[model samples]
Target: MTRRILENSKVLITGGAGFIGSNLTETLLNQNNQVTVLDNFSTGKMENLLPFFSRKNFRLIVGDIRDLDRCREAVQGQEYVLHEAALGSVPRSVKDPMTTTAVNVLGFVNMLYAAQKAGVKRFVYAASSSTYGDSVSLPKVEEQIGRPLSPYAITKYTNELYAENFHALYGIDTVGLRYFNVFGRRQDPDGVYAAVIPKFVKSLLEHKSPTINGDGSFSRDFTYVENVVLANQLALLAEAPEAVNQVYNIASGERMTLNELFFCLRDNLAAFDLEIGKVNPVYGPVRAGDIPHSQACIEKAKARLGYAPVFDVRSGLREATKWYFENL
Candidate 1:
């Protein structure tokens, strides 16, 4: 017999066509769980989920999570709700704070309210590593969150707050996973707001110079997408009542600098006999609302949710690089 989460669950994932959401959809469907994905296609693409378009257990809704009726409809009869829809990018958010706030905060509240009213078994959301904003801590723990630096970071922190309030007032089981720099397949490499890994990998593959946003000393805990999936699975399945209404750091529990990541990507591309272009990264001033360093402890997730991230940066990058080579 399969686990309850696998056997009888109908999961709803907002933004299910984006990089992390699409990967999570693939994982859940593989686990024998029914998955309903609601995406607006603003950043999410149908190509990201083209492989699963024919699966009976998978359903797709082309809608925005910001809409109350859509949110309510998506939450109806769902066992677990994984809210991943949001405008993500510090620089982009800094440029247009209103759009970020509307999507990340207002959309989050709409989803939470809808899920709570629908009586979903658990509500888990994608928080960000940016929540540890100005804290100069080396390895960030869940309990010690600093002031948010960017509009995006503030919105993520706001998600945690809304989740906690919903859990407390409405008896909704909510867990927030503060994800670090998640990277892997299906990540958009063309957008100006694309993440670091995909952007660098795409640039390197295209024989272009990858731009470093700041001095190379800035570091991050670049978590893989698989670890995030595992964290969400645990958040949905964990039976401990104490785990409700809390936040957990979802990461690989390691750290690497941007310069280090650049070289690593270069080397991986080189392995394919793809002549690595000159590693001349154009330097720019540090962008606003960006933290200098970030690393997650992940002990809370380990002890509470049994979240064991299987892949570190190197293993994850190898797989990601292979995917980029094959797909891009």
Candidate 2:
């Protein structure tokens, strides 16, 4: 196992009550770091943070990112900032661009500016694969990107630009991790804008048919949350001048169609209950702002940040399925 790079530090996770944020907080707390979470709990669940409520090292700030004072208060004396607080979902963005822009764009700037003023060592924020809109590439790369297809994508790409500008102008070190479809434990499956993996798992568990937005042939580089956590750590560890102030794709480096993903989830969960295997999927119209395919070229991350994804999609699905079966 690679050694843990971040330990005994004061770190702040902006969306600490959310799935990826909670996972990062849990791991960091165990590694002997003092972790604080700033979340308004709009989409984040208190259930996710309930386990850590009693921990002396864990502090919770009940505030929204759109509030600059809250953002400033959260970053006080923090060595690093994992900026994961942003409104997600392309469909939701398409539905209400104003709300998405306010939170994902304006709120993002608030957090970034806060981290800068506090003299934080490194600011690592979550970018998105949606930024690779309409690009007909097999494996998406960092330097190459197409026009954003959604407001959410625009916000994420804007974040990249802001981070770069911040680094160039203010000299605050920043790293942007362009995460693909991230999933795992603590990922909420009940919301209207629920992610595909957990939503599918939840549906099958109830013996209900899950609807595929497209023909199910659209592929994605579905990354497991554990790999994303590791990438965050690596991004923190990468102190080289070139490594900082840049974005890297945090993904499995493999691709699978939505149909294959559904079957994988079905087959994995079916081992516990055969009824789950009998469940069928319903087809629906294609959603706006969704690309036909998405895969990542991890060579840059591997070479620059020494990031190697430890879990493939199937292995991640197995782990995520077991969690859903037990917890859901």
Name the candidate that leads on lDDT: 2
**Clash count per candidate:** 0, 0
lDDT for each residue of candidate 1 in 1-328, tens digit (9 for 90 to 100): 2223445479999999999999999998887889999999989989988999888899998888789999998888898899999999999999999999999999999999999899898889999989988988779988887888888999999888888777778899889999999999999998778889989988888888888989889989999898898888888888888876789999999999999999999998888755764555777788777788889998888898887888999999999999998889
Clashes of 1: 0
- For each candidate in turn, the TM-score is 0.96, 0.99
Give the best candidate by TM-score.
Answer: 2
Any idea how many clashes model 2 has?
A: 0
| Clashing residue pairs, backbone N/CA/C < 3 A, model 1 | none
Q: Which whole-number lDDT from 0 to 100 does residue 276 have in model 1?
A: 69
Alpha carbon deviation, residue 249, candidate 2 (Å): 0.5
Which ten contiguous residues of candidate 1 have the minimum total lDDT? Answer: 1-10
